[model samples]
Target: MRFTFTCHATDGHARTGVLSTPRGDIRTPAFMPVGTAATVKAMSIDQVKSTGADILLGNTYHLMLRPGGERLARLGGLHHFMGWDKPILTDSGGFQVWSLAGLRKMTEAGVEFRSHIDGSRHMLTPERSIELQADLIGSDIIMQLDECTTFGSSHEEALVSLELSARWGERSKVAFGGTRATQALFGIVQGSVFPDLRKRSADALKSIGFDGYAIGGLAVGEGHQLMCQTLDVTVPELPMDRPRYLMGVGKPIDLVEAVHRGVDMFDCVLPTRAGRHGQAWTWDGPINIRNARFAEDPDPIDPTSTCPASSRPSKAYLHHLFKAEEILGQTLLSWHNLGFYQDLMAAMRAAIAKGQFQDLRARLRQRWGFAPLD
Candidate 1:
C-alpha cells in the first residue's frame, strides 16, 4: 500500500488514526521501539512484534558505520536483513553526528565527523543521508537531514541553524526523487526553544512538502513544560493531512502529553535502556526491580499483561536475576517495557475514540507523578 494517514477520531488536540504503509498499518499515537543496530537491544524481533508495535525506528548513523548501508541493500534491505517485515522509519544520521560535539565539524554542505567506532572520517550531507535511508535501507518512512539545534541556544544561533535545516530539507526532498512512491520522506522542524523560529521552520517544511513532519530538537535537557510549549507553537503550523512525529521522545508522561498536543508518532531508547539498568515502567509508574523490597515480592511486573515476560516472571525472580547480573534480567525487563509502551498507546487510542482522552490523561499524569495542568 502507498503511504497515507486517515484520522478516525479526535478529542481536543488529541486524535487517533492509522498510518497505512506497504508493510502494515501503524496505529496512532504510536510508540516505536528504538532498534539502534537493527535490534531492540535484548528483545528478539518476534518479541518486539509481539509487543503490538506496528513499526520500528532504525539508526542510520550506526547502521552505516557497522554493516554499511550498501551491504544491507545488497542483502535485500534492512527488513529482510533484520528479519522484520513491518514498516520501519530511519532517521538521517544528523543527531548522532551532532552529538559527536568535539568530534564533528558542521558546514553548509553537511556534517563531517569521525566514526565513534573506529575514528574513521565520514561526510553526511542531506543527499547522502537520503540515499542511505531511502534507497539503501529501503525504509518505509525516512527523515530529512536537519541540524539538531541544542537547547540553550540564543535566537541568533537558532535562526542560523533553522535556515540551514530548511535548505537541507529541500535537498533531501530532491534526493528522494523517484523513490517517493514507495517511501515517505519527512521534513524535520528544528528551532531550539524559540516559538517564532519554530513556526518559521514548520512553514518552510510545508512549502517543500513531505509525506510527514517531525518535531525535533526537544527532549535534550529542556524540561517537559518547555517541550510542550514549543510543540504548541510548532504542531499547528504543520499540514493536518500528514502525520506529525516527535523524535526521540519515549517517556510515558511525555508520550501522553505529546499526543495531547497532536503528535501522532514517537520513538526513543528509554524503555530498553532502562530495562538493562533494572527500571520497569508500569501503569502506576516506573519502579526499580533492583529495590531491596522486591527481593521477595512474588508478583510479576504486570499480572494482566498478555506478554509472557511481563506476566509469567515474578518480581522476585526479576530482582534475583538483576542481583546475579544475569542476561535474562535485561531481556525480560526489555520485553515488559516495550509491551507496556504498546499497551499505553492502545489505551490512548481507545480513550481518544471514546472522547475520554482527557480523563485518561488526567489519571495517567497523577499516577506518573505529574501535577494537574493549571
Candidate 2:
C-alpha cells in the first residue's frame, strides 16, 4: 500500500489522523515504544501490541553494531528478524552518535565513534545511515542523519550544526532515492533552542521534500517551558499535511502539550525505563511501587485498566515482586506503563475528534501535577 496520512479532526492546533503504511494504519497523536536492540526491554511483542501501540521505534546505531544491518537483510529485515509485523520507524543513529561525546568525532562527511559495547570503531555517514534503515532494516519510516547539539549552545554553534544537518539531509535524500511505494523518509529539524534556526532547518527540509518531519534536539534538559516555546515557533513552519513527529520526548504533560502544539507522533523510552525502576504511571501522576506504603495495599495499579498487569495483580504482589528482585516486577510495570501511555493517546485522539482537546489538556495538566497553561 502507498504511504499516506489523513487528518480526521482538529481542535485548535491539536488534530487526529491516520498514517497508512503497507503494514497497518497508525493513529495520530500516537506514542511509539522504543525498541532499541530489537526489543522493548521487558515487554514482549504481543504485550506491546496489546497496549494499542500502532508502531515501534528502532535504533539504527545499536542494530548496526550488534546483529548487523547486513545480517538483518540476509535474514529478511528487522520485521522478520524481530517478529514485529507493525510499521516500524528507525532513527538515523545521529542522536546515539551525538551522545557518545568524548568518544566520537564529527566531520563534514559523517561521525566516527567507538562502540560503547566493545570500543569497536565505526563510521556513520548520511548515506550509510539511510541505507541501513531503508534498505537493510526495511523500515516503514526512515529518519535522516543530522547533527544534534547541546541544550545551551550559542546561536552561532546552533547555526553551524543546522547547516551541516541540512547538507546531510540532502545527502540522505539522494541516498534514499525513490522508495515511496513501500517506505517513507523523514527529515529531522535540529537547531537547539533557537527559533530562527529552527525555521531555517524546517524550510531547508521542506525544500528537499520528505514524507514526514521530526523535531529533534529537545528534551535534552532544556526543560518543558523552553521545549514548548521552541515548538511554538518551529511547528507552524512545517507543512500541515505531513505528519509532525517529536523525537525523544517526554512526560505525560509533555505529550499533552506537544499534541496541543500539533505534533502527530512521539517516541520515548520514559515509560519502560521508569517501569524497570519500579515506577508506575497512572492518571494521577506516577507512583513508586517500591515505597513501603504500598506494602499492604490490596488494590491493583488501576482497577479499571484493561491490561492484566494493571488490573489483575494487586499492588501488594507487585511490591513483593520488586522487594524480592524478581524479574516479573519489571515486566509487569513495563506493561502497565505502556498501557497507560496508549490510554493517554487514545484519550487525546477522542478529545481532538470531539473538539474538546483544550478541556482534556487542562484536566491532564491538573491530574499530572503540572501547572495550568498560560
Candidate 3:
C-alpha cells in the first residue's frame, strides 16, 4: 500500500503522524494488536475492531504451520480467512524461524529451518518472505526477512547480524521490488542496540529503498531505556516520507516514549498475553483481576470505557470468573487491554493534531507514575 506520513506534531525528538494505507488510515503512534493465528486470542473480530484499531498483525511462522498460508490464501486471503477486512501487517517470519525452529541453517541466500509445530522443513529468504506475504496471505504491510538479534550479544556478533540483515534487506527489496501495490514492503533495521550499527543499518535500508522502515531487533531482551535511545538514533536516519515502524514493542510507557521518539507503528502480544492471565490494562494502571481487593468491588472494570466488555462487566463479577476459572475472565481482560491500547492511540492522535504532545505525554507519565513496570 502507498504510505503517506504526516508530521502533525513534535515534542523534542518526539513526533506523531498518520499512515494512510489501502485498508485504512492508521493514525501514528498506533498500537497494532497481534492476531498471531488469524485471531487476537480471546476476542472476536468485531471486539478487536471496537478497540479503535485500524490495523492488525499476523505471524508468518505460526500461520504457515497451523492453518497454513496457502490454505488461508485459498480461503480468500488473510482478511477473509480471519474475517477482519482491515489493514493487516505480517512479520516476515525471520524471528520465529530462528527462535522457534529446532535447528536452523543460514547462508548468504537465506535461512532453512524445521517448523516448530510439525517438524516440517521450510526455507525463508527475502524473496520467499515477500512471496509468502504477497501471493499467499495478502498483507497490507510486509516486513523484510532480517535477523532479530538478542540484547546480550557482543558488538562483533551484532555487527555480523546487522550486516547480514542489511544484505538480506537488499535481497528482500529485489524480491518485493515492484511498483507500489496495495501491499507495501518495509525494510527492517537490525543492529542490536549499538548506535553506529543502527545508523549503518538505516543507511543501508535507505540506499536499497522500501515503502517503509522498521526498527527491528529491539524489544527482544533490551530494557525500555536502551530501546528508546536506540530509536532516538535510528528513527531520524530513516526516510521521513515513509513510515517508521518499531516492530514488536511493549507497555504503555514504552509506547509513549517511542512515540515521543517518532515511531509510527508497533505490534505486540503483551495485552492479550496479560489478559489471559487475568490482568486488565486501564487508563489508570494495570489492575490484576485475581487480586483479593477486586473480589467485592462492584464496579465496571472501566464504566466509561469505549470497549463493551470493560464498560459492561463489573470487576467483582470478573473476579468471580477468575476465581471460578471461567473463560470469561480471559475474554473481559483481553477486551479491556485492547480498549486501553485503542484509547492510548486516540489520545496520541489528538495530542499530535493539537500540537500538545509534550503536555499530554507528561500527563500520561505522571498518571502512570515513575514506579517500575514489569
Instruction: Note each model's CA RMSD in angstroms.
Output: 0.9, 0.8, 2.2
Q: Which residue segments of model 1 deviate by more than 4 Å?
A: none
Between candidates 1 and 2, which one is better according to lDDT?
A: 2
Which tens-of-lDDT digit does each residue in 1-374 have in candidate 3?
45566766666666667778777888777899999888999999988988899899998878887788788788898999889888899999988877853478877889888876667888888888888888788898888998888788999999999999989988888888686566788898988889999998889888998888998888887898888889888888988778888888889888988888778888899999999999888777788989999889988988887688888888899999989999988988888898898898788878877778877777778788854333
Output the number of the lDDT-best candidate. 2
- Please give the clash total of every predicted structure, in order: 0, 0, 4
State the C-alpha lDDT per candidate.
0.94, 0.95, 0.85
**Which 10-residue span in candidate 2 carries the lowest summed lDDT?**
365-374
Tell me how candidate 1 scores on lDDT. Answer: 0.94
lDDT for model 2, on a 0 to 1 scale?
Answer: 0.95
On lDDT, the stronger of 1 and 3 is: 1
Deviating ranges (above 4 Å) for candidate 3: 371-374
